[model samples]
Target: MYETFYGLNGKPFSLSPDPNFYFASRGHQRVLSYLRYGIHQGEGFVVVTGEIGAGKTTLIKTLVNELSGDTDFVIGQIASTQLEASDLAESVALAFGVSNEGLSRSQIFNRLQGYLTQRRLEGKRALLIVDEAQNMPYSTLEELRMLTNHQVGDRQMLQACLVGQGELRARLQEKRMEQLRQRAVAFCHLGPMSQEETQGYIKHRLQRVGWKGRPELHQDALDSIYSETQGIPRRINTLADRIFLVAYLEEKEMVDRDLVTEVARELAEEQPSASDESEAALAGTQKMVSGQGEELMEQRLSAVEERMGSLEKLMDCRSLAKALIQSLQRT
Candidate 1:
């Protein structure tokens, strides 16, 4: 919505994992390298773990695009979330181009195994990439493990890459699944970007979409971003995207500390302070809400008048919190 005001070609901080807007921070590069190593070597069970929105999907999308037409390999990706074993078989069968009409469970399994074996015998490797794997049920996971039994005499029929938030690690360590855990040939945990990489991450994304003007972020602003987001790209982007609009609409090229703070307060998913109101405080909060986004109520923050402490200051912290909650929910 604020792109033209900022004079940009497109939105710089969209949530979609578009490859054209991808920026490989140091952590990303290392993860990509490991993924390359895993796929090329036909690692049996590759694992990529990261915090939410740390760009795991972006890396996987890029890898899939790069490997799409390769004659030596075939790649398929599935997003698993609370699906049963039969549903998972459907997902797998769909990825392998099998029609599901009137197909029995055993028939579907036979078709997948047959396809994997054919690829293995033809000197081609098969790759299955599962996203949000933490949501997968133990039954479905066991079904997945069963697929590993397909073989061309000795070589395995396919390799699998499981990508999910951190919980997947614990899920894999279950006592009943200890045998499957041993099959992992590669595993890496993706963390947030480093402080310096945080700065580069912003610039890299901006430049990808034809950003030619000087970056409007001050050094201090970037430092605050790094600190507030703790180098998490998704949090950084959330703060940055909102500030982009505020600065653009105000015709200010540079984003500053105040803008970042307001954006942070307005974009955070949780009200961390929602329930801190007495009857009097709640009444004052309702009044403060009507005056928010126009004025910051600095007059109430004189330290002399702020006897109610920092929470209410007539600043409408609740409104800011409410705005963020609503915005994210709409998304």
Candidate 2:
């Protein structure tokens, strides 16, 4: 909504993972290197673990984009949340364009093997990337390990890459996964960017969307952002998006430290504040005392409308939260 006002070509701080907007920080660089090494070898699995919203999906998307032009590589990516062993197998089959409908596990495995072997014979390699793999059942993971056994002489017919949160690493250490751990060729843990990297990250994304610095960010403002978001990319994007909206609303071309702090405070207030709770209780009491329910309801709705009208100028998180609360009250 603020893009036109800020002269941006598109939304710069969207939460979705975009390969074109990928930022290669130090941690991401190392992770990419490991991924490259695994892809080059065409053998064992490469495990990547990170915190939630740590940009793992973005990294994988970037990798796929980079390798898309290569005719000799086939990459299939699947994302899941707490899937069963059979369900995961079905997902993997579907990801590779193999129909698993009403098919048994062994049947799906046979089809996957045939597909991988056909690709290998055509002088191409296949990589299956499982995102959010921490949710994969132990049996499913072992099934993945068994698939890695497919071989074309000295080379494996298919390679696998596991991308998930930090818990995947701990899960792999279990005795049940000993064979899978032994088969893993490389592992990398993606962490948050540094303070300096965070600054560059924001600038990089802005530049991607044709930002011309209409609202210049001060060093202190950047510091405030780093302190608030702790260098997490998603958090940084969220705060920066809101900060831009606040600036646009106030007609300020310069975003200073104070503005950042104020926006942060307002976002914190988006939750159920004490005053909001008291007002809710008071509204209930008024409803019980005054038998004229319609009049009191109209009064409350008028007050809510007035407050929301004022908030229309700044459509930030706090404003949205307040509108939602008032809407619930009206209902």
Among the numbered candidates, top lDDT falls to 2
Q: What is the TM-score of each candidate against the true structure?
A: 0.79, 0.79
Clashes of 2: 0
Superposed Cα deviation of residue 40, candidate 2 (Å): 1.0
> Using TM-score as the measure, which candidate wins?
2
Residues 117-220, model 1: lDDT tens digits: 78888999989999999899998888788876567877888788999999998888889777678888878888998899998998888876677664467888
Worst 10 residues of 2 by lDDT: 80-89
- Badly placed stretches (over 4 Å) of model 2 are 271-331
Error at 118, model 2, angstroms: 0.9
Please list the C-alpha lDDT of all candidates, in the order they appear.
0.81, 0.89
Q: Model 1: residues >4 Å from true position, as ranges?
A: 269-331
Q: How big is the positional error of residue 56 in model 2, measured in Å on the Cα after superposition?
A: 0.5
